[model samples]
Target: MISVRVNGQRFQVRAASIVIHDGHVLLHRAADDDYWSLPGGRVEIGEAASATVVREMKEELGEAVTCGPLVHVVENFFDIKGEPNHEIGFYFQVALSEGSPLVDKARSYSGLESDLRLMFQWHALLDLGSIDLRPAFLRNTLSTIPLVFSHVVHPGADDV
Candidate 1:
């Protein structure tokens, strides 16, 4: 579920993914081959969202990403493992260094399939509208994005 201005208090929600590089946004195609999404997952117990982003990115893409302030937060509601639920996803600004990702001991950390075999790639921000996303989530996200921000954000939820 995305964040809402409930009585003016900013309650954080989900663990939204974000990674910007050369005007392109990193997207994740789950190993199960479901719908594509920004590279991220639910916030682990006791972990901060920003930290989660850093850890998740490092695990999924095989690179270290520098993250910035909270650019936007979307309320996400979806079916996970057959359960309907919601979360407030914080989209922090981030940057990726220039290079190809390599999975090797000398290059990075340890792990096997969960950290390696996943498929991720970049797509032009301007082309985001072509992606299929959760409708309610995207509409609310775009409507609230601060106009001054220009980082390549997702289409919020849907409309892409």
Candidate 2:
């Protein structure tokens, strides 16, 4: 909701959740997207990043989650629809609250955001390299969560 365009490029601050169970990690993607990413949303004005993660999970999954420690802070630059964009992302550890049905769901499912449908799934940590998970660095970071917080910068296509 805090997205803005500056100098013809989009800028946003996003908060994402890292939810892992068994050997799989939870991820979601818009129906039209070819890649999957963490299940969180833009950081709204006046809301803490952690709070955004909690709020997003509820709104997207219809389930309450307990926000945990900050995991990673990423300055991610990328392109969307061929338009350059910049985003600062806060990745937080999270867990579904007790008695939430989604905790044990093994198969992929759909969640709704207004009229848009989002696909949610649990992917085996060992198989992340095969998926087009965004930020690219996450393919390795998610597999071995750092003991201390980490800050990462993912260069955009032009910078590569």
Candidate 2 residue-wise lDDT, 50-160, digit = tens: 999999998988888999999989989988998888899999999888776776656787899888899999998899999999888888988894435889889745674
Per-model TM-score, in order, reads 0.62, 0.93
Q: Rate the local accuracy (lDDT) of all candidates.
A: 0.55, 0.89
lDDT of 2: 0.89
Worst 10 residues of 1 by lDDT: 103-112
lDDT of 1 by residue, 20-100 (tens): 555455665655655656666556667888887777777665668777777656654454565444456667766665564
Query: 160, model 1: CA deviation in Å?
Result: 20
User: Which has the greatest TM-score?
Assistant: 2
